[model samples]
Target: MHFSIPETEVRSDENGSTYVAYNIHVNGVLHCRVRYSQLLGLHEQILSDLYTFFVYEVRKVTKLFYFLPVVRQDPILGSSEMFNSFLRKAQQETQQIPTEEVQLEIYLFSGQKVKVNILTSDQTEDVLEAVASKLDLPDELVGYFSLFLVQERGDGGCTYVRKLQEFELPYVSITSLHSPNYRIVLRKSYWDTAYDSDVMDDRVGLNLLYAQTVSDIERGWILVNKEQHRQLKSLQEKGSKKEFIRLAQTLKYYGYIKFDPCITDFPEKGCHVIVGAGNNELNFHVKLPSDQMKEGSFKVTRMRCWRVTSSVPVANGTANPSSSSKCDVKLELAFEYLMSKDRLQWVTITSPQAIMMSICLQSMVDELMVKKSGGSIKKKKRLNGSFQRSDSQQAVKSPPLLVGAEVFTKLSSVSLRGLSSSNSASDISGNDFHGNYAFEGIGDDDL
Candidate 1:
């Protein structure tokens, strides 16, 4: 059983009429044909839903299909198909690696210590093989981080640690999700990898081979605790005492859950915000200039949404019903968004909710921006106290800012064939592999 799908091309006409066409051959039979007009994003969702059906059908037969999707030609992979494909591929069984791509955030502490956060659409294997191949770090412990721990169809589906401590002092410690700040903080001094790659091109903080980071999401380092995690119990249906208590601790310890007012330094035109987790499935807030936000007068007030996830209705008190005054600026959130690389595109809503979502995403953004040369230069003179490094790695350079879709395009374009492919089960193990794999999903069609 094999699934071979032709690369699709979707484009809109001057009239804004979008057309999409693709062909799929399953088991050498042209079984499905997909055609749609406009709404490429929605079309990807429908295609992903189709994948679930196909996966079930394939499993019943031989379970040896490629589910081949031509690399590059499909915009659906990024605009919408990404999440859906990830869910389906995680359950796939075959020698071929699924098209799902994993995104990660690596935090570099001064000295030798480091922390990495892995974010992937597919939750299959858990080693930082692809990452390690790019970096010069020793392969002792490859950590995994997630809000939810998945039992590998085995191990009761509980989460565990995979760490490597071969390096000298100030080396990395692995912990998943929110490991309640358990490790000892030797000193407040810290050195961060540049948020923008161009910042220090000459300085390879961690000499990387496959360290092809698509983008830097933010700045500040993450806080994780290991001892508290080791003591917790695993309870409920697929539950872990260590992980949950750790999450609660992270929220309280950081006072991150506490409310903060919305503030920013940029114009409200190209600006937007998200609330909750970094995933795009969350809510959104769009800030308009006093002139564009015509829902009456634009007042400088936070707006809350009717729903926790969606901004369906606008809560009152954010703006005047007249188009006279404009809303004041909350530019701070925009700077914060540099941390998480804006993988998720939140939905739009009213006052406080808009403010809340903006508050969260911006923090991530700001963190990353500070790492870039341009960002670092702006703050170099002002940064003070323990959080600052001696002669920060901001001497490199900075690239121009691009839209979210463009960033994805750049990432997908990088050849993954550089990473070793999966090996036979005989050699199957954690964090070890030997093969060449080219990541195919979007951006580059020549592959």
Candidate 2:
């Protein structure tokens, strides 16, 4: 029942050419030797086809064992007795374990770890509530915070992988990753920066914000000048958590989610840039080939629409064309940028982390809309397993800007084609563009 690919070995073919092969083992016994190219080829196949291929292979093995005697042969083909014993032991072990309750370790924004007990079937919402209860967070204010699956980097910085969805079981999702570096950290989730004032009123919330802000400064996520740093250190000594947060907010990229380096087709094509999302804008630090860096910002309000596109390099023939080799996926995040009152431009950025960029942008827009409506940020309501807007909220005049892959494909054929041709600002005015195309919300599925 235990399967592992122990190691890879270099081997020679009949033509005396060297290639690498993997030793696939099952329960300490070698089952098969697969070449690197073969594995790549298998991976290239579509998921449904690959599933069918595995099923067919299993059937063949089952039939071969069916006709064989019960006598033990090579260890590669495990004996029937041993197989049945493993199955029985597995069943017994499964039965002995209690699935009703499980212990989960959740981390706070300040790197504080706390353990809570919850049911195995508990969803993210239930787990969040349990964590909040442990922290004694007010019920009304619970919506201001969320649980995130974050990956801790070796250099002390951390990456926000994704926000845990309401429907997902946090325990199962974290366990399935099989990595210790990934942890569920509770952090403030509201878009409005001013909301931090409300959170600071509570002792626990104030400490959480202070810890996170200080961590961000030390981790170099927030930029602070020498004098500002000195002031922050003084505040830290005085235990001024509120003042520290207030000062930190004045620093560049404060409250922003930073993304890894990516390539953007802005100012010029294939410009390397570091992107950050926060304060209703996508901030960029473009690094030029001449070793110079230029700063820019894209406001969310001016973004007419945006979409994420992904393609496997192997399929696109951008990688090894003749050989079936596994290749990295290429992802592009394209947004309609308002150049002027009547002019729009399409800006595209290429990065493996494009989806995350899109999510952050959409989240920023959601928060902006909430702030514009003069209402408090509320948790998105889930109705029948989907998000539903409450009737109390005013309808947004502008259509949804965040789009998925399918809509991107359609837009590529129509809007892209139209936009490619040069037109005056008056020709494609804001009113004309908005009136012509209607968009829907990106929805929970994009997460």
Candidate 2 structure quality by residue, lDDT tens digits, 1-447? 223343446767789998775543222223345665544443344223424433333334321111111111112122223332332233223223334788999997666797999976566777888988898887667778889878898987787777775434677667756789999998788656789898899987788888878877888889999999999999999999999999998888888888878898876688898888887668878877777677767766556577554443333533321122333335677887656545677888887666567667756655654555565665546556434454424333323123235542312110111112112222233212221111233222221
Give per-residue CA lDDT, model 1, range 11-105, as digits (tens). 45569997653433322223333443222443354455546433343233221112222221122222123433332332231112334444443
TM-scores for all predictions:
0.20, 0.65
Backbone Cα, N, C clashes tallied per candidate: 76, 0
What is the TM-score (0 to 1) of candidate 2?
A: 0.65
Q: Per-residue lDDT for 228 in model 2?
A: 99
State each model's CA lDDT, in order: 0.25, 0.59
Which RMSD values do the candidates have, in order? 25.0, 14.1
lDDT of 2 at 395: 39
